[model samples]
Target: MKLDARSAARILRDPGALRVILLHGDDTGLVRERARTAALAVAPDLDDPFRVAVLDRDAPERLEEEVFALSLTGGRRVVWVRDATDAMTAPLKHCLGQASDTLVIIEAPGLTARSRLRTLVEGHAEAAAIACYPEEGRALEASIRQMLAAEEIRIDPDALSWFAGLLGPDRAATRGEVEKLALYAGRGGQLSLDDVRACIGDAAGVSLEDAAFAATAGDRAAADTAIERALAEGTSPIAIARSLLSHLHRLRRARLAMDSGQSRTDAMRALRPPVFFKRTEAFGQALSLWTADRLMDAAEQTQSLELDCKQTGAPDLTLCRRHIARLAGTAMMLRRDR
Candidate 1:
């Protein structure tokens, strides 16, 4: 049996008495989502310990015994095995044969149509297979609209068209971006075309903003490369400064929005330039270590540095490089302070 992510939720709630439920997908998010569903469904009471058994596919030798043990354990038991490679096929098959009432959720990537595992699961009466792939076109748009609706946000068709172009194909990434757009709208508003443009801007702005984030996160190697590339493409020092300022401003706004009753997804949308949806978690991680005050201070410092670069006879490239390095170090320093 095959199912998509939407159907997985329903399956979890009323998962029939299958001896084994194999949840496999190429997309990491789908596999994890399904596995999580299985885990939670079998052990809805999180306090219960012995009801769930987790194993790695690499350790399939132990899986059969675990299957036998869990099948006899009280209520529904889950045996979750991750990273099922070809070498473990025999052991997995043995375990599947022995598994009685236990729900065996296996997470595997790189399984082709002709793969042995695929054949085994499809043939097994007790097992079900699910494919998790990147969304496209109408499917992608529908998901975006659904997520926005959840936050009480509406986007005009024009804005939705532009918004779709700016998002990544991954489900998590798509969900993340819409969340940013929604929160940016706040309560009772439609996401406009202008909002989408301002949030992600053109390709150049996207690259610069992503580079600035890399710098702020202490990835100096990536920061150096991204900064150099932007500079080579005629991105002005003032423009780079303004971009960082925009990022800082939004980080501050996102922090404030989060402090209010809004969710992080909403807070991200509330941000000025709108941090990419995929980056919300990183921004959240950044929040605990730094504050709006600190981010504003960094921006002010960058402004001063920019002024110094303008007033000096120093080489423009050299001065720009120095300031970007400093912006990159700000988060590290703030993290140390805490």
Candidate 2:
């Protein structure tokens, strides 16, 4: 049977006799969390020398033997295989055949309809194949609400939606961010949009990232405000400089791709989302004027700014602002030169 991540409660309530559950996903954190939860449900004591086996995929042929040993122990045992791949096919099949009332949990990378391992688990009478993909749209919105509720943290619907969107692609990161935000909010309190914005959205790390995007797009005003916001929110200057350098380094590569006859669409396909959309227009405008050399120059300037922020005793915020101003100025000159 295939299971949804959120439906674990319902599924676990009535686990099948096979007791062999394979929880797989790109999100290893979530996969491990589920496996841990399930294992504890069966064997609450981890240090009791009980019937519980946690096998890393890197382990040798010991996994198959471990499964068999744990199963025959008579007591209900849970064996979870982490970082599983195609190499575990033979071992997994062998264990499944001799489950002996033991629960075997396997975590693999994200699987598709064509995945052979997924097919095997789904086809089994007693086994379940749970697919754990990054949630989005309604699924993500619902998950954010559910996760907050679990932590006894209430969020307004609007704030919930905002966090859901902000947390794109990484469920584990989202969970951690929510936990931090909840801690910041304190006990017996609800988290507001301002809390979300303050803790997660407008955080120094997040702001620095935004500033880099703004700078790359030649939006000096936005970049300046983002830097100021980051600093005001207690973001370290060195961290902001490092983030800026990283963004510029990526931008330089995208610009080079454009220079190499790759169309904007193709280049955008290669670039990560939001970054691609945010800079698509600016990059197009930039391509009309700035040569690869100019972009490389900007990248080098970013590196220099990073080094200066780290090595020099100069105030970090001022150094970053000055470097940003110079970069914007250079971009303006390049734009005019076109």
lDDT of 2 by residue, 1-338 (tens): 77665566556545647566777775666676677767777777755455877778787377776665643445677777878776676766776776367677788865557777777888887788876765666787787777667767788765665455445345666677778877877766698766777777544566776676666656689778888887786655655655665566556666678878887557656753224344466555545545667667777777777677666466767888887777666666666665
Model 2, which residues run further than 4 Å from truth?
Answer: 4-9, 12-16, 70-75, 110-113, 201-205, 208-338
Task: Give Cα distance to truth, residue 238, candidate 1, Å.
Answer: 31
- Top candidate, metric TM-score: 2
lDDT of 1 by residue, 79-167 (tens): 77887766656766886666376777777866777777777777876767777665655676787887788778888776775466444
| TM-score quality measure for candidate 1 | 0.52
Per-candidate TM equals 0.52, 0.59
lDDT of 1: 0.68
Pairs with steric clashes in candidate 2: none
